[model samples]
Target: MDELEFMRGRVYGADHDDAAPRPGRVYAELVGGPLDGLLLDVTDRTERELRGGVVLPTEIGRHGPGGGAVYAPRGPGDRRFDWRGDVP
Candidate 1:
């Protein structure tokens, strides 16, 4: 499997044996920062949610549990989210 396929299993869990995206489930690749290369499951998120971005907790982040990694979609048509930075 390729890097993304490997990450899909790692991020979504081992039970997800299939590399192909599941129907109705939206996924975006995280670019840069602590969560780089990880897939964010935005399946149930709305367009506003995607545009406003999200804060995800990560052990590798600068502030650990006190802060989170900020990620926002590059654009409406982009499938990758760029890391804005860490938030406290």
Candidate 2:
């Protein structure tokens, strides 16, 4: 199957630079732009592990730096991604 099939239409505009969170580092920080210094998801996956964020194509608002995609949580309130290695 194609790589897209594996994503299941969750991520978009991905150019391959995107990567899973490093081990022990659960919080995702904004590298640059207006949202710089911002801490995003708390996924506790290592670089060699799977992506912990479960975002859909429709959920992604735009493409981030280095081909990484940015997505807003579907639920209400502040966006808080699971940091304990829990997948959606």
Using all chains and alpha carbons, the TM-scores for the candidates as numbered come to 0.73, 0.23
Per-residue lDDT value at 83 in model 2: 23
lDDT of 1 by residue, 1-88 (tens): 8655456424432245654556677788889887787777777788877898889877678887778899989998587989999987
lDDT of 2 by residue, 6-86 (tens): 443221233435643344644544333323333454444443332333332222224433233333332333333322211
Question: Model 2 compared with the native: what TM-score?
Answer: 0.23
Q: Which stretches of candidate 2 lie over 4 Å from their true place?
A: 1-25, 49-88
- Residue runs of model 1 more than 4 Å from their true location after superposition: 1-9, 12-24
16: Cα error in model 1, Å: 11
Name the lDDT of candidate 1.
Answer: 0.75
Model 1, position 52, has a per-residue lDDT of 81
Top candidate on lDDT is 1
